[model samples]
Target chain A: MFDTLAAMLDWFGIVVFTVTGALVASRKQMDAVGFVLLGTVTGIGGGSVRDMLLGRLPVFWVAEPAYLLTCVCVAFAAFFLAHIPASRYRALLWLDAVGMALFAVAGAERALLSGTAPSVAVAMGVITATFGGMIRDVLGGETPVILRREIYATAALVGAALFVLLSLAGASREAGLTAGFL
Target chain B: MFDTLAAMLDWFGIVVFTVTGALVASRKQMDAVGFVLLGTVTGIGGGSVRDMLLGRLPVFWVAEPAYLLTCVCVAFAAFFLAHIPASRYRALLWLDAVGMALFAVAGAERALLSGTAPSVAVAMGVITATFGGMIRDVLGGETPVILRREIYATAALVGAALFVLLSLAGASREAGLTAGFL
Candidate 1:
């Protein structure tokens, strides 16, 4: 039951990241293919890095085509939807935040399962949470959030550590994610 | 003596990566600052991702100012030299191959020392080898080599596995790298 919920959350995170990436690509006047590329990278780049680091096989997206499919579908929708004035940047930012929070918790959990130390797991969590956006920004010719004087990496670190602490205390994964986000 | 040699090789790799990245930026009509960004990312991005995966702390460039300095200096040089008829795209491709080869061996060695399995070490090696170029291409709005019909990732994987195998058979690090490259 919890596994199902976690899977759903992961899917949600992927969709949100894709949407945010598509919106950014739109602002850059990129074509539809470029939007899809950015969206896919934003949705999977961090987790792919984390998995490769942890020595996990097949990578997260390769292991399950669902995430990749979701990203593609979301990007296609966003390419058209981004034409609407209602696609506010502020809303995309908020959604990206939510996605980041969820991905951080997921990354930390995966790191812990890979037998990494708590501190390392926390760091991986932050990497997994923020790296997609960082890649998107860099590719879009914008300064990465990590390179800027932003609260981005710090927020990811805090959220990841909080999730780890909650999970170590025997909280459910959903609870841990909620605690981290809150 | 070996340490000095290793340091030289590492710096050489850094310079090559930085030059290539800066050249790409120049072709894109990016300014000096854009060249700097591209150069830095190409030089350090691979190793940073490798360290993050190996659970290493602070990342190499973040720990060693010299690495970042080297990249910055190369970027500055490349920026000023951009007006030369360098046929930068071809040069960038070849330089990228060298960087990939060096980084692949280094990353595999690090992973092996950290007690990762041979297969995982090889994967890490590929990540270290290709990730920077992936970042460079993506940021430059080009398709990543790994995602293309290139033999790039395969080359890295073969080289990394050879390195790990040779090291396990008691070959020196230098010998392993040479064998891997060959």
Candidate 2:
């Protein structure tokens, strides 16, 4: 089912973001607790914000403990692997891009399911894709990379909007999502 | 009416927090944009997070533009007044405490109105009281005062819990709110 696929993608995105958060924390020489906190927030912050704005109760992570466990485990893994070559950051960036793409589609799809207008759905997608990273950067005392360079937010916005338009044009849900993800 | 009184308190709290935010920006010698952004975030962050978690749409400032306007104006004013004596930080701290008290009560009341469990309402109150400052500190690259020392979050939590208990004991809403505020 599409819901199952979506959930898988969501989990994948959370793991990717969590690792990125842990990487950042390790670079800052933060303690284990700091790594876990950063990783957890970065993994869940965006979707949590979106759910809150939608008046959804029992935030997604709170409702599902699996996500929390995954983040914690990933944080610990990343912490121990912090000495991996600097090239790991390049991999992190690519993973972040994939995560952002999936999260954007997921956010837009959720907003549409909630009966929001198309524009709102698109906006929600951008928020979901970007907020986690922003929060991570802020908490780590770095200016958010999204605001500096790169078309990060722009890519998410376009992807979400494209998905919405494709859906409106009667494309299959999977097709629309795939197109957006690409 | 109770609504009017609540609105007044909310506005007062926003202004106080905004000023505190701008003061932080000034202390850091940030640019004008920094001042406004910090001020606005510190003024609205807690309530916005609370609303998002509660599934409240559009957030409060989005529904009421006046709060946004007030924050912008106050931020600019505070930026210019940054040269005021060093004693201003102390005054700002006290004002922040008052804002925290008011916001904590308001947050708890709103959560109760939304039918959240009493403990959840108290948590929301603490979040609404502290999150804005945390965001400001994080973005400004300063450690959040709430995490360092002081009874900041504890005070908010206690106030919210007291309000809930008083209300459960059949106190008038105003009396419960006043008790929490004090």
Candidate 3:
């Protein structure tokens, strides 16, 4: 049940990030292919960066190509449904925040499992939470939201640190994850 | 002798790219640490991207700590020596171009050695040649040079493709490298 919940949360985070990427593509007035490209990259990019830093071979999406297919389908859905949206900007921001929190906790868990230093785990968590959006924004021809003097990254950092510390202190994984996500 | 020369060329390309990154930092009027960060990232960023795409475990710098040290030392030297001002803009452009060519061939060679298809090899070469500058420019708060209406990427693509084709046609590695670098 723990693994199942964790996996579901991870997929949810990815879907959220993919929606955000496709929304950015819509804002950029890109073609369908552009939406898929941006969305897929945004979905997998953060985890890939974290894995590369931690020396995890094949990254995750490479070993399991289902993630790429999921991103494509999600992005396509977003692209089509975006036309019917009335006020997407606010929802986009909210979804992005939720994705950030989920990824922060999940990334830290992976780092801890890898037996990295506590600090490295925290850093990886923040990186994993934020890097996908950075790539999306950069590739979408805009300045990244994190560089816009936003407090979002700071929140992620604090949350990630708290989670790692809690894990190190022998707290249950579920407790730590909830604390980090909250 | 071939191995020695190949290694020397690789290091030269790194140094040249590092100088361009430092020049970008200088243009941005960044401090010493910022300069170092930008320089080292520019020096190794392209190769790292290539390694990640090819699923090369540990990336190059992780497996060989010496590369990181080289980047750090070179960046520091660049930071200190940049004050000796002569018009550096032209030198920066030329150095970047040379570095791009060298990396293009080297990256293709690596991709082919990993048994990727010819097209993938060419693509990797271009990514390894250009991704560093893109990262440096993006992080330095500027649009990437590749995004500009420039013939640079076209040149990189042509060069990379030619190198891969030459290798596929049974030309010597040295010959392909030379053709690509030219």
Query: Each model's DockQ?
Result: 0.06, 0.15, 0.12
Question: Each model's number of backbone clashes?
Answer: 1, 2, 0
Question: Which candidate would rank higher by lDDT, 1 or 2?
Answer: 2
TM-score of chain B of each: 0.92, 0.94, 0.93
- Each model's iRMS: 8.6, 5.2, 4.9
Report the CAPRI category for model 2: incorrect
lDDT of 2 by residue, B31-93 (tens): 888889999999998889888777776788999998899999999888888778577668767
Of candidate 3 chain A, the 10-residue stretch with the lowest lDDT total is A57-66
- Residue B56 CA displacement from its true place in model 2, Å: 7.8
Ranking by DockQ: 2, 3, 1
Q: True contacts preserved, each candidate?
A: 0.04, 0.20, 0.12
CAPRI-style quality class for the chain A–B interface of candidate 3:
incorrect
Tell me the tens digit of each residue's lDDT in model 2 across A4-78.
877877888899889888887777777665676678779988999898777676577644557767887899888
Q: What is the lDDT of candidate 2?
A: 0.81
Q: What is the TM-score of each candidate against the true structure?
A: 0.57, 0.61, 0.60
Question: Quick one: RMSD of model 2?
Answer: 6.5
Deviating ranges (above 4 Å) for candidate 3: B1-47, B53-133, B136-182
- Candidate 1 reference-contact recovery: 0.04
lDDT of 3 by residue, A1-182 (tens): 66776677778889999998888878876666557666876887788899988888657765555776788799988878887677777777887888888888888878888999999999999999999999888876777879873777887888898889888899987888788888
**lDDT tens digits, residue span B86-130, model 3:** 877777777878888888877887777777767667767877888
